[model samples]
Target: MSETETCDLFVIGGGINGAGIARDAAGRGLKVVLCEKGDLAEGTSSRSGKLVHGGLRYLEYYEFRLVREALIEREVLLKSAPHIIWPMRFVLPHSPSDRPAWLVRLGLFLYDHLGGRRKLPGTRTLNLLRDPEGTPILDQYTRGFEYSDCWVDDARLVALNAVGAAEKGATVLTRSPAVSARRENGLWTITTRNSITGETRSFRAKCIANCAGPWVSDIINRVAGSNSSRNVRLVKGSHIIVPKFWAGSNAYLVQNTDKRVIFINPYEGDKALIGTTDIPWEGRAEDVAAEEKEIDYLLAAVNRYFKEKLRRSDVITSFSGVRPLFDDGKGNPSAVTRDYVFDLDETGGAPLLNVFGGKITTFRELAERGMQRLAHVFPNMGGNWTEHATLPGGEIPNADYESFANTLRDAYPWASRKLVHHYGRLYGARTKDVIGAAKSLADLGRHFGGNLYEAEVRYLVAREWALEANDILYRRTKHYLHLTDAEREAFADWFAGERLAA
Candidate 1:
């Protein structure tokens, strides 16, 4: 028989929302068990457009409340995780054929003032022909607007939240699926089976939070045998990665003929990430992939604004994710609400909180509110505290990453600047913990190409719940993007050997 544990909260997902909720609940003195069937953020959470901004276009749909909350949360998130989230300037080259200049200006104005703007710079008008940001843009776009937002390593954000939850006395079970959940004796009995180790564990939880994202409905019906009146509308969004053609550090936001806006952002060290088409999807989330037409559509959108045209051959890679939006009877997938909905099913005294329709930008706020909804059920849980708290590795003094980067370089003067910068951005104050007492590059152990070393890999496996090579290469870090084909294969082979030996 598998060992059974008692917990105050049982969260049935490991995506951003579920991880965030687990962290918040644990911080409030609740014993939480967060279970995931795969690596953290291996699904939709890692495949975001990588921005922590108030959805600028959501304003066009008159979603003022949603926009305002996201804007406010943007500031809070930036303050919380400056290491992985920082201010980014987006240049929107005005195309009179798409949206009028006045309308764009109006939206920018509201975006600046909608939430209490702090730390981040406000919007500004620009002469596209004169500004450095306009150099790569076509001459036809004479005027433009530059606005502020923040970029995030989406996968790392989810991991840090899970780490925070664990630090606060929460059990984070990765690759463990909740196979059975039933309401019994005013409590919930949840059983989880480890897919990798063939180990089974059960928990007696007072409440359950169904933050299963796209699988939210499935968990309610299949696992818990509980039904929800709410449903998720799966919207597929795709992105393509290409070699960075532009010279500036800034990102671009352009309008397509279909009235949808596409973002072309500077990604990694030398890549540009262009994305996202909102198409209604009736397929499984795991089966989502970027179609050929979607790639061409993104390239065509970019060609419309830039002087240098992109070819389909220039696309290095493409990925797709399903946005589990709440069904609001809206026919247009783009018009679906980015806001979240919570259905608290308090049947038979054991409550089930089902979350639906939330974006990465508003996850913290969503988690905070979801916990507040169960305040009566947990009459003694702590009050809201994540609002101003720093995430793991984000404890830099004053949340200043650049200053911390310089300080880190000084600390490890023997390390290359690129290595220092990589660790600084990814791990921040925790870089020392990853590197240990290593004095030089040679002391860092086997180098599997790029800045990846044995030290960091060991730390991730030991502390960050990294299990397989994909979890380390794809989700926890982006080492696969920089490593060559042969190098990646060799690393994977070596990782398998190491796991078997362990």
Candidate 2:
């Protein structure tokens, strides 16, 4: 039999929460091992609405604590990773038939003040008839409200967390699933199998953290053979990508007839990311896809407010994700609480921490609090530190992305404006590592379409754990949106061939 490796912590799942916990625990001097069934953020983490905001709508549910924590976290996350996270303005067009003006104003006021509003600007009223923001709006909606929120590259956020954890001496294994776990001799014995290599590995961990998101219940019952009173409610949220009809960088939030608000955000420089229906999901999380009805429902909501009407054909692509909400016995999916709950099951001498229902906005806080729950286990571990620490590649001086980008442009005078912007936005201070000794565009090697080059691909594979072409084309970078079908196929072929050759 193979030797059983040992660690202080064993983390299941590579979603945002797991990655965050691994990074937090590892930074605090705990030996950590994180195993993911698929690529990092392949689940719900990458498929979020991509906002780090105080859930403006959650205030209706009276979730003040969650909203407040998330609001405060927005600035913290922005400072930590300015490259993938930044401020975004949301335009909410007023509809008399939906929410009353006074109620909307009150919500905005609370949203502005609730979390100790600092760097972001306060809300402003807009005349849809006169302002350029109203150009795409219908004549009926004459008033609008604008507020602040932060946008994040959800996939990149997870990747950075994994990177941060690895840098802190945590073992991060992708494409490896924890198949079974059992308590043995006052410790948890976990067995994981690598899907690609068909190699099984065993570990003896002092404790286990189940951050499987939608698969939390499965991990608890099936994998760990543990029981918890807490349950996860799977709610499906879907988003559609289409050509940008509106002309501004600001996003639009319109109220639907059902009293739900849909966000039409600017995406990929030229596309609009419109989302999200809150429907109770009963299917397997992996099989979840944007249904035709959901797509039509989204188009109808946007068309009701915008002057331009979107059709079925206008939808370029769509995605769906299941939000594993902590079941609060709410009848309405929309009314269900977004707050997270932790279940610490110490059945025997071993401990199993099962995390349930957390949003991307409060992931760091969740990790910090999760670690606190295990403080007694690691009494000598370091105190809170990530609050001010920057993630990998986020070490831009003063957290000023624009200033850093300007410096990057100066350093790479031979690079194109678009290429420089790409590297600056994605790699930040690590742009030099990707560019290396390349003096000009020719040094970047074969152009695979858009801003993707051989050098960038090599860097992602060598540093970011990018094994598949989709990892680079879709998640690591949005090159899929920019590349032609033929170009994408050609790139995939090249990637597969190169991998085989290696």
Candidate 3:
């Protein structure tokens, strides 16, 4: 048995909510430990639709509070992490067969005004026949509307939160699962075993935060031996990556005949990300995959609106995530609320806060509110600090990304514009830390592929808890989509030989 450790709070998930909670708690002067069963954001957090929007479709369900909160959070996050989260224009072409044009206009009006509309521009009507944004659309559709939303690098958001938590004195353990947690003498006796090293550790925590996402109930019932009347509805949404079909940077939101809107967003410079089919998933969350029908359905939706048609072969890759939604007694999975619910089971004074069904957009607010819920448990904790604080590497002056990019270009004139942009976007003010004293590209060491270099890999392993190649390629950065099969294989071989695990 390992020596028993103690912490003020034990967080049992590495997704957005869990990381957000850990970061908030740690910053509030609480000794925290965040243990994840897998790599950070390897689950649903990384596999989202990659937008930080107010959920325009959610308006139909009358989730005004959820949309308003998310919309407000949109600007908040954009201000904090300007490098990764920025404004995006979404073009929605109106069709007579689906939603009424008047209804769409009404919703857009509400969306613009609901959140106190700041920073981002308001919606504008476009004549598809005359506007350049409409060039990709079919000639029959003459009118469309463009609205504002923000695109996010979802996985990096999780990593930055975990980084912030660790920096604030939280112990973050990746690939370590809390196998057991029991209430003994008004304290949580928890045990976590590292999956890689096969090492076990014990802890006596004052409280436990169950932010296990899709496995929220499993942690409550199996790990903590606690029960919750609140339940999570496992709704699986899938997305596909295809070559960019349109000519612009703007994304398209097409209304499908089934009443679900599918997003075809620009991705990876040269590719387009199309997705998201809302289907009820009964199987295990880990086993969720993008079904062929879901892919076909997305293609049909995009093809209906665009002149260029997509086929099965055009799909470069696809991914799916099982959303752990708070079951609101809604028969339709799409109709389920994206709002988060907190269940604090304070039996024996050992509080266990269980978070359920939150979207990526509202994670910071969710964390703040979650901490407020635990105010009784942590009376000495600090006040809300993340509202204005920036995440790790998001320390741009006035959140001006263009000015920062210009500075980087001036500093590293030897580096390509593409490489500088990569570092600027991913590392932001920490770009110098990654590049180090390198005066030229050669100082960056062996180039794996794309903008990926040995220096970046080493930096990720050292700072971001990247123990696996996929953790670097897939999550911390999206070099996987840019690198070729040969480059990836070569990089994996190099990573294994180096034994970079700390």
lDDT: the better of candidates 1 and 2 = 1
Please give, for residues 398-481, the per-residue lDDT of candidate 2 as tens digits.
999999999998999988889999998888888999999999889999999889999999999988888889989888888999
lDDT of model number 2: 0.93
Estimate TM-scores for all models: 0.99, 0.99, 0.99
The regions of model 2 sitting more than 4 angstroms off are none
lDDT of each: 0.95, 0.93, 0.95
lDDT of 2 at 376: 84
For model 3, residues 1-502, the per-residue Cα lDDT tens digits are 6999999999999999999999999999999999999999999999999999999999999999999999999999999999989899999999989999999999999999999988999999999999999999999999999999999999999999999999999999999999999999999999999999899999999999999999999999999999999999999999999999889899999999999999999998999999899999999999999999998998899999999989999999999999999999999999999999999999999999999999999999999999999999999999999989999889999999999899999999999999999999898999999999999888999999899999999999999999888999999999999899999999999998887442
Q: How close is candidate 2 to the true structure, as a TM-score?
A: 0.99
Clashes of each: 0, 0, 0
Runs in model 1 deviating more than 4 A are none
- Rank candidates by lDDT, best first: 3, 1, 2
Looking at model 3, residue 110 earns an lDDT score of 93
